[model samples]
Target: MGELQVEKHVKYILAVEKRKDDFESVVMEHLRLNGAYWGLTTLDILGKLDAVDQDEVISWVMQCQHEDDIAGLQNEDGSFSGDMWGEVDTRFSYIAICSLALMRQLDKIDVGNAVKYIVSCKNVDGGFGCTPGAESHAGQIFCCVGALAITGSLHHVDKDLLGWWLCERQVKSGGLNGRPEKLPDVCYSWWVLSSLILIDRVHWIDKEKLAKFILDCQDKERGGISDRPDDAVDVFHTYFGVAGLSLLEYPGLKPIDPAYALPVSVVSKVILGK
Candidate 1:
């Protein structure tokens, strides 16, 4: 089952390569930093970074920058633009930073403007929103925290309030939600837990229940993970499933540094500031 699942993921990667022009077409069609980041990061995680031209990728990602400081923009409709057509959101910003850092283009980013954009996303609740004036969500908070961490500006966030918001995500099912009144899901387990780890307050939540919920979301027979128990499995949830387990220090699973939210093997080199 495990090998088959691995093969499925491998085929996804191969498909991305076999249709490189199509992939690039989609990327260019969006032409946003975050979208470019998503494409590059997906390739990077798959060990296919060389499949795309580093310089072209770097240049395209750079085009999404507003000056050197801010990395994303608002779409014409103002709905949280990205390389897609919407206003900027914290999640994409996180992806953009990580993608650039992974590509070793950290030096080219305008740290200050990026910080400004991150700061702008902060809400009165002490947590961050996807965009200015939006409600605070666990996912967006992760992006905000992650972007700041990459740029060495994590201190700009209000940790106490952010921690409180993250802890509130835990529900009776041992799962976490992205926002208030949302259903518990496995993906948020990583989003919320990683945020807690970032602020060193993971202990405030129910760890045992959270871990159980995550495990239950795994497709033991299929060797992948779903957003919730009995849900359809996909790559996004599968990656987060492994990530959440790593956050809990699960035995036999690789550890993930919540601060960088990448596998320890990859995050360690990033932390070394290389």
Candidate 2:
């Protein structure tokens, strides 16, 4: 079996960020904040976070948050928009909270309102959706669960029901799908698996099989992971793949917190001031 191309993967991530005019960067401009988090967290997990300029990253992150508009983003009903377009989603809630938490600026927003908005997205099936009344999806569920975890509002989650729904995402291929009838993908390995682990129900899934599935999706030559075997690789899937392995406690990789989605040491320093 081929091993993770640790050095090559790190170089690939750094290169992607530097190529601002590239197709991937252009396409991801709208969600640059989310991309930064993924890349930075991955670097941290690989023990190479120091490769980037810390002050520069923090400054760019603050600009993305737009401190002046923080209060305005919270709707009267508590939902948040990914941008000024006003399309509310639980995913934005997670992104906002996770980003702020990493920067140690969580106090800028109303935690109570944010948590309430996410709770409003919770469905009767014990899952969460992009917005109230929307159908639940694994991606949205991870966002909701992750946001709640960051805010210490996990009480809003129906652990048993959500856990059942999440574990059900695991398919015969040992890979997980985003929803019912969807094909299995490596990305869900992070989304569904992390949510399940957070609710203390990860034991319900086949960890060994899931690990193998993620490993099989890796590009042994180029050093990035794909959504599935023999597919093209990208930074997004690469982060998720490595993160999923971290969650599974794969040897030689850093351990990641299911909720915070950062290495335990980084989460501790950010949350605990250690």
> How many residue pairs clash (N, CA or C atoms closer than 3 angstroms) in each of the candidate models, in the order given?
12, 0
* Model 1 regions more than 4 Å off: 1-81, 84-87, 270-274
Models 1 onward score TM values of: 0.70, 0.88
Candidate 2, 168-233: lDDT as tens digits: 999997899998999999999899999998889999999988888888887776677889999998
Per lDDT, the best of the predicted structures is: 2
**Lowest-scoring 10 consecutive residues by lDDT in candidate 1?**
1-10
Among residues 3 or more apart in sequence or in different chains, the pairs in candidate 2 whose N, CA or C atoms overlap within 3 Å are none
lDDT of each: 0.68, 0.86
